[model samples]
Target: MTTVIFVHGTGIRQREYNDTFEIIEQKIHAQRPDIKVAPCLWGALGAKFNENRASVPLEDGTLALSQGEEDADIVLWGQLYRDPLYELRLLSLKPIKSRNPFGEKPGDILQSRVASLTPTLELEANLQEAGIAEIFAQARDTVIRSQPYKGALLTVSESDLSEYYAAIARAIAAQAMFISELQEKFPPILTDAQLRDKVVELLTLALTEAKLGLGGWLLKPVLGLAQHGGTNYIRRNRVELTDKISPMPGDILLYQTRGEKIRQFIQEQIAQAEPPVVLLAHSLGGIACVDLLVQQQLSGVELLVTVGSQAPFLYEINALYSLEYGQLLPEHFPEWLNIYDLRDFLSYVGNKIFPERVQDVLVDSRQPFPRSHGAYWTNAKTWEAIISRLP
Candidate 1:
């Protein structure tokens, strides 16, 4: 039996992941009665997936899951919160090298210092209370204003709040590494000063990498509703477009950079599965699935389908030759059809996708949508089209 793996996206909560998987499964099963489907939960929150001594100690001391929990294979899919790791790296005792010679606002400087350490719920609340939120708003405004004055712009610029969150993630991973090193070299009962030194060292490493200096490469530009003007911009407009089928857990941002971690977990899962699997990913999850397929590592995936997906992950592959370099090429889709809705902001339009090598179907989504992001399976026509295309 083929296993369908569901990888979730950012701002997704545990219960929402479960419910979406259930809805998708029921629809898929009704069409292809024999398939076995499952949802994989990865670390959407920073602390939840800490590979540190603290988590182990806490689990051993207080609460722990019972045995036999491994009945089904576990895969950490979607985005992982990496802000904690970045934060750890930023918090090293060594004074962080300031790229901005003018120096950041006092609150910005202080919040960055604290955010680079562990994420305590109270610490976050305190940062907001202490005017860091205002500092960030001012920073955002400064960046916008400095658009014309290129030279005066801060050398270490983080374009989005997501980047700051990512910094927090870097801290967590760095902390875990620091603990691992401590365990390896030092004996039990380390002095407070020793711990302080370690924290400084880690933070230094994180700050160095996070520096957005001239000629530094940019990863994926944070894609979402734009801040203003465009129909796709969701941030500036406080419009709630969620479509609900039931009373399920709402979405949440667990930690920064959770996307990358989730993607890695899914890649590992696909690689290790005993039986061939089918990856059905929606929106950003679809991008993660395409990433796995293009790696040429998953020999077991019979088919891969992306619905209402962002194009870059699949379009850049070498398999689909019809696409042009830097011009949005469509290539090497894994033995299945890719579906898009016209009004869905996640999916793109235009360019000739090879009908023979890789199938592409576009659906009109201007009609009432169930949700702003995930209406692919909920719509009857979309489900029918998907069922027809399955192998």
Candidate 2:
């Protein structure tokens, strides 16, 4: 029997994780019952956050619960909310020998102070209540106004301001405990204006040191918000699931912590299965699969299919574990086919990046942004591509 291993992407909750893959498995089974399907479920180990219900207006002029079984909350909130925070923290923590007049690098000094502060749950809520977004916007405007180009010509779309919002949110959340203490310590003297100025200063410094260009700043927040939202949904519905999946911390960090579990699972599956195995990986799963083939040097995969994955982009940023800088593609790499939808912002082309034995195919899922990312599982073209390539 042909062992078909399925790998899922980010922000999947315990309640619906199996169903997400089962949907694809059922499709594949209906076409080829002879195939054996197994899923590598790692989303159960993702970070948990609280979910709050909000009514979203539909096109039909009715309201609906934003959280759905197949909703994009995992990708939207986990990656978006936590990724930027992780990046900023990493950037600020980088060791620098250069010292300013204060005998410390500006970035290091500021981050050290921010890190020293302890955040409480109550403080986090208070900061959120204080309108952190407005404080960030005002600071950003001031910074733009002081630039060479007048503020009139500096234009940033709402979409572009996503990362800034996320970064601001994270910074606030991280430092909330300290801010609350400060408020309590100086309730009579500390004013809202002073607090706002402090937040702007902290965020501006963090952004500048991170070297996130205007575009990066914008994109990070948008992605972070999605990740934050998705994680919250998972946390909210965590108790409702029959199968209990433990919560893990960090979006990208989860890869480091739980990647071995997935890798071992795939390895065990391949070892027991017959030769010419067909491995189908989606989203972060694709990244893990590539790392196994290229880095771990695992073999026996006949055909490797990656759908709607961020592998190419992640590699460019040097994020892939096995595929490091200046490394050549493995000689024993399996024949690879990458499928992506144009509207899926997270999906990217891998042929150019790994041209040795890779074929990049683009499909029109015709679904909206985040929906397009998950649509590949059910798309006729995706199934056709997988079936045609199976030996």
Candidate 3:
């Protein structure tokens, strides 16, 4: 029997993580019953370090005298910044506003506009004469709220505010230009009243498109702001960021590498298993596994499977443990298989970076961004790849 040890990613609640593991185990067992799957359960150990308590009604419909709650069980404190107030503040950054209007670059926006434009340059010129330039500038300026006083509440610095507004302006300009081209294609047969209505409809559509484009750019910075604030909040509450239920991915990586609990658990599990170990790790878990293999010079790992991992990027940034700035892959490093979807921004190709004994497979996961990252377990291609590689 092949012993498959599963390691999960960061930011997962304990119960949710366990449920996911169970689902994956069931799928794997259906194909290969001889394979015995076991969860590393490092997340539970991580959660234990930051336990809390809350009153809860029992099965008898009475509150327990002493209640026990794992830090991981509390979702609110873990995701406080998800609140509307914080989100609105984060979205107030100028760069965020600009990027939020349009997701593509000016060139892409222009190309798309030109592609969709009517062949008549005269109509296009007339549309350009429709006062769109002024509207575009106004729309862009409004994307980011301009009150410097509001920044005090959001904790945005003056310089950042300026930069944010400038980005929003640029995005608005690009979007306006794109929309102006479409405005020219308005039906020439319309009467004065009809033309007024048509122009309103076109301008409204253009503004919406501009916002959509800018929204994509705004997302990253907004997320960064939330993460920074969230970390500070966790620290201020006398909670070690790592011990918090929903620690940042970077913090989770640090704990997995330097902390004793998770490493010890994996060591214990490996020592007792009789069959060759097939290690399956996802996202941050993959990074932790690589750290363990390198730092401990661990042996007996027959195969390593990583899905939706940032290992390649992390390695390039000198984040992985036991791997030095310029060191090559160790001779004892186990054969590895990496699975990733192109839509998952966190996932990257590993074989190009680590050529020896490593194979990277790109699987099409039709899910949207973020969802694509977590879709690997349920994806048929992912399972088939793992099962075929089993020794």
Candidate 4:
């Protein structure tokens, strides 16, 4: 069968990710029925990879690849092991073939000799040859930097992984129930800082419980993104900045059940699909797509529509981070809508009406109910505006 593998990326729960994909599928199938659509969930907190590998290395030298599914062609994408395997395969190649080559041709001997010698040295070398060792080593660290996080790392006793998997299952199940509720509610009005805090908390909790041992490495960037997102959300909403700013948005919005992770999963699904996949990410999700496109991590996101989004602000926020580190913004942002609610604090924020910043459409949503930062996507007006953008 011809297959479209939807690879969900980082930070999202699976069920909500699939819901967004289902929304896109509905739009596409209405026009064309021959295509098959599927969401290949990569699970959260790198869980899918971990689960695939099964036995992770513990404080003890022993490790196992946990679940017993030994099929080599697991995902069928071929992207998973191709590059690494190809590099390894190159190591086994023989550059020079010698039968009685003690005194063969000099020219062939000189060039072939060096090529043969190179692989010999390369094979015996450390994992730096593959270049993934550092990341793996960091993943193996035993101690965490903070004491408060000790309980988190330790929570993932061997028996706890099954529970962690179950918890993720529960998180995704709860999100599935909550999604439709989101469609009807007004967007919440938490500042970017507030949103970031929530994301950080959820991520910390998730990582801690899972025993990923990646807290220190993941914390700053995660917090930074959340805060940056929160700040950008406020600036985009045009909430009047106090002389002394109040709380920043937390990392996780808590309402939509981790929008960034869901957004990443959707785009990843799009990237893995056959041509003609439609994608609709509300608010920060659109921001995520723009970032994905900019990073060249995904492509071919046909019929992309973002409801109540803040794509431009992401550029600015990324620019702010890049400036702080003396780096350059990589590429131009993509084309998408910036749906806004006039009454919503996030809607009044910076460059809200400007079209030059990647097809900005200042959508005015008349929220039928009281809402905050997370409610903007659920507003009926927002959906109506988005329907116009869908193919």
Per-model TM values vs. the true structure: 0.41, 0.50, 0.52, 0.33
lDDT of 3 by residue, 1-391 (tens): 7899988877677787888889889988998999888878676555332224222112233332211122211221233212212323444443422343334443233324323433244333433454453444443344333343144224333224332332332333333444444566333312233333334334334322332122333446544543445433343443343344435454465574565666677777777776688889988778777777766656678888999998888778886655765688877788899999999998887887887667998898899898899899888889889999887
RMSD, every candidate, angstroms: 20.1, 17.7, 17.8, 27.9
Residue-wise lDDT of candidate 1 within 260-366, one digit each (tens)? 55557787777666456877776656655655555445667777777776544336453222234454223544575577776676674323543354466777655
Runs of candidate 1 exceeding 4 Å displacement: 43-260, 272-274, 313-333, 349-356, 365-372
Clashes of 4: 48
> lDDT of each model, Cα atoms only?
0.46, 0.58, 0.58, 0.37
**16-92 per-residue lDDT for model 4 (tens digits):** 67775676556545544565656555344232332432343232323333221111112111211222122112212
Give the candidate order by descending lDDT. Answer: 3, 2, 1, 4
Instruction: Arrange candidates by TM-score, descending.
Output: 3, 2, 1, 4
TM-score (C-alpha, index-matched) for candidate 2 = 0.50
Name the candidate, 1 or 2, with the larger lDDT value: 2
Q: Indicate which candidate wins on TM-score.
A: 3
What would the per-residue lDDT of candidate 2 be over residues 1-391, giving only the tens digit for each residue?
7878877666666556677767877987897888888766656545444332122112233333354322342343234233323434422332333334545344343334334433344443443545443233333333233221121112322233333433443434333323444445333112464454344344444433343222343345444554455544445454443123323224456776667766676677677777668878888778878888875555668888999888888877887787875566788888889998999998899877876668888888999997898888778888787788787
- Model 4 lowest lDDT segment of ten: 68-77
Deviation in Å, model 4, residue 243 alpha carbon: 31
Q: Which segments of model 3 are wrong by more than 4 Å?
A: 47-245, 248-257
